[model samples]
Target: MSEWRIYQGVGKPHDGIDRLPAPPPWRDFGNGEGEMTPFDRDMPAQGRHRLPHAAAYQADESTVEAVNTALYLRRPLLVTGDPGVGKSTLADAVASELKLGAVLRWPVNSKTTLRDGLYRYDSLGRLEEAGVAQRGARQDEQPTPASLGRYISLGPLGTSLAPFALPRVLLIDEIDKSDIDLPNDLLDVFEEGGFEIPELARAADVSEPVMIRPADGGEEVTVRRGMVRCHAFPFVVLTSNGEREFPPAFLRRCVRLQLPAVSEDEMRLRAIVRAHLPGADEQAEEIIELFMQRAATGELATDQLLNAVYLMSRTVKEGAPGLDGVARLVLQHLNVTAPAE
Candidate 1:
């Protein structure tokens, strides 16, 4: 709802096909032909994103629907779940479905700050320039705009706000790992599409004033007012490991979804097969079933199942594995002896 003022381009606003540049030969901006191309454009056609057919995830249709809605609304998705339950995978799923782009992951930690997530303003470079300008300047001359702005670098959060037709998906992984106030700070930035580059704002420009774009990308567009407006609202997905609770104010604005630890049956070979694991062997099923039953007592995590499958696959690939091989698979891959009663 907040608005940021933007200055007009030095040239006239681009129009029609001429305004649109000739797309790179390889990329598909969605308007082209039958097959999907990888090329990203200034403006991409917005549409519904299809999710991957993972049975474990699909079992919870509400969760999927919540995520789909978040992507459509361009709001933050809060995922709360046990560790190793594939909370982070949701972001990947959304990115894959929309063919939007890889998730711009912002892993949260205790020390993570708003500025850390936003772009870094080159403090040292700015200091060095100030020194150079001071030494070169005549007594009457004052510091110039060029001396102040070059050292500025935008951070991940700020970069995510960069203007584009297709908004990039931002995965704020494990918000619970950081301090409680982190979410509030993030909310402020999300409400405003862009943040000001303090260094650049000090300079006076007739045509363009504020520089805005992702940190990694080597371009900046001028933004006006105190806020940045989004052309395409970013698909912001925030995951939590369930170590703590969030404030009500923050919770009120977000659509929260919880991912449960996958059931033991969900990890079995039959389950895996149903989930689209092709060429599953009978031997694999027996071993997986054994592990799943033992793990039901809240012992081994589901991640071990993936390891077991890989081992089973390798053994089958290299002829029938003996007892020693199976033991090795259980011990080395699963990282536990037979589950304790």
Candidate 2:
């Protein structure tokens, strides 16, 4: 059995509503033509990075259910939670447990756009290279069309939508920070299972099928006629800090799940502390109690507690002084309001 229960549902469930009858087979019905390389060959050897303490991180039942639902239905999972609640880490856990290649990440910002997620074309660099080629050409030699493939590279979304033998796992971090239109803009791509690259499309006649680099960085793949479509839809995990609301249309297409506060459970808090600071004993309980008390009064993130535990553990191990004062400083709540006089 896998260390995590989430991986057990890889291809088993089929309720038709949230689960598909079977995994979608790889098939290309669009203008794009390409083959997905095996995970061991094309993917980076490092796999997804995991913290030493992440082994003990646990997910609630609802969160696990949401992940399985998204996997079976091939739908994007919209995870909303407070900061440091492990919204983004969920994608890493899924990729790690399922043995999915790598997590293609797109960190969203206030200015992020839909096109930014699809691909980026370095026209200027290509032009510079073309100039160099032209100047070096002999009197009888002619420069061929600048390699369009060299200039274009796929982004997170495009890479996910590429024709892969198995579905790629994608993490769109802090999507709530994106512009209002970004969510709606992603609807078409999510529904269509593909997107077109106009730059490559315009040059299709000259460049029938070109090998281009994908976002994940590895061997290049052939893109036929500038159209990139997916045989297997990517398992997309979009995270938000609950800073903004999304359109109903966007929400309709996604499976939504909210992460509950960890401070509510004493056992869970202890587990997190033990994972991060294995040496912590009675100190772990004291710190967790203090953390819960502070959390109950103001805005606090789980990482703050972890940081305190780590510092205290290090201090004790090194026989350092001022452990209490240091813990107090690091464990202080982040609330801006002034404490009672």
Candidate 3:
């Protein structure tokens, strides 16, 4: 029933996520917890969000259902929406509300690769260190497992896979901008819930766990036997701008979500304004009307109204020049230029 939803999307931090039921058997992996680092305590929860604490992300019932479904199934959420439509904020909202650690963001680009998201090996650096050690005398002194592991740094995707006490929130932003092959490349990792580090696997000492740094900038995590497995599948959120179509095989593994434009909901828009400025209800209403009117036929985003309400309204109320000009300039369509009358 609806009571089983793990993420309520209420903008209030709670531990309800801890009560999530077992993941599907097919998605299960090793149950070992990630080695905790001293910095783990310092990891920022939802309070560090750019959105105001009042409501970092205003989630309607539909959004709540999509997110909760993703959480329950232990599947990656593939969210598609217009730019600035709060696609990325969904990750932060879930993390903040469920007391998940800071959102791990992997912003993809055309040049991004699967390895770029998983981990980066400093092969050149390792080779350089080996040369230095050989020349300095010490029997060629091949770098120890500890030293070699230090050369490998886990990216956001890699960090999210580490077996941890709780599920980490990963936001793979704008995945549609990635290279065509990137989506297909992710299929294996999603199915396996882990990846292998060949460098460590083939090393002289393959028995010991190697410690590597996580993309979150926390202390190194131990990858036992060159494998990074998850105790709990991370809450992975992959965002898209509807720019490209993904392969069918890749799409089949994800929970898809279509985000409505912010202007479509007047109450949500007002909540966003009031979250930033507690007493801006009147300003919010006025700007909301104007924003919706232009947004009806244009590509104005929600933040434009936030800007107009916070800046233009604040200025006008303080006895400055009227904000008509300011609002006009701030709320312009994304793809057009206004006439300079």
Candidate 4:
């Protein structure tokens, strides 16, 4: 409720984002009315998975603090955690709670580059189309056809950078999975809140401001003079499974949060179970205890706990219900394989 804390984590829609003071001169892109993506429109009807995941997310004290800090500072949250500790769900929770619309996610991989997150142009396709156009045109006339904007579409990361009044939630899942230097490459854009689309920039003189579909879907965004800037910095969540190290500069810019081990939080686990399988409370604790035991041995995911409980509820006939064979299979670790006979 404090004036400085824009995100309350209450999971209710509010205009608090509007009340947020202007970003420090450096982070503020401009005052222009930003475009609204489909997610920025009616969310309840967007048929997105964000709401349900948001409803189920149970934020602890540390999570709430880190989230608010990132929101208030307009910085990316670098969430480091064991796999499946709900690192990525944080984006959905904030988007759903704040009525920010759908989360724009760019799932990073070994081959992902900064440009991969940006717009993609069908250069060859355009070339081929131009060839066809030239062939069809009259001998004395010029070949006239569509513009390059028709071949360009923004990706999730590019769409998030679109000038928007309120921020969109962008989940850069598994940042550690990206090749080295990618995080460094992102620093400039993160600070500038925009990037020049060379394809559009080069054609700026030849074309009017282009109207093109954004990756987030819904509304067409206007790209003027080949540059995209934001009125507000989108809330960015970069998740890492502690898979690799990031450059110190990237670390400094991000509000780093290392999620507490899920096994250590008993009450939190129970709450998660209650949120998911309301009636499974009867055997939830037993399943959770075993899950924690397995988690202690090696890598484990929170979903495995949910999966086990769901199975137990259906199969726990009269008394046989303590981490049964079927449940053990579900609780298997991502890193630890089953012991040989």
Error of 3 at 132 (Å): 1.3
Q: Estimate each model's TM-score.
A: 0.70, 0.85, 0.91, 0.91
As for candidate 2, its clashing pairs are none
Clashing pairs in model 3, backbone N/Cα/C closer than 3 A: 34-163, 163-231
List clash counts for every candidate, in order: 7, 0, 2, 0
Model 4 alpha-carbon drift over 4 Å, by segment:
1-3, 31-41, 138-146, 316-322, 337-341
Q: List the lowest-lDDT window of 10 residues for candidate 1.
A: 1-10
lDDT of 1: 0.55
TM-score (C-alpha) between model 4 and the true structure = 0.91
Q: What is the lDDT of residue 187 in candidate 1?
A: 70
- Give the alpha carbon lDDT tens digit for every residue of 28-95 in model 3: 77564556433342245423543554245778788899888888888999999888788988887887
Model 1: number of backbone collisions: 7
lDDT of 1 by residue, 77-158 (tens): 8989766566776665555544555456688899999888876666777667667767888446544444443555556566
Q: Candidate 1 at residue 80, lDDT?
A: 90
Q: How far is candidate 3 from the true structure (C-alpha RMSD, Å)?
A: 2.6
lDDT of each: 0.55, 0.73, 0.80, 0.80
lDDT per residue for candidate 2 within 1-341, as digits (tens), equals: 43324444332222222222344442223333456644442232364554443345567778778987787677899999877777877776666556566778999998999989999899898778767777888345432223777888989898888777667889999999998989999998988888888877876767557777888885565677777888667889999989888999999899999998888888888877776677786667777887787788776788888877767666675555444675567766666772631
**Per-candidate alpha-carbon RMSD to the true structure:** 11.1, 4.7, 2.6, 2.7
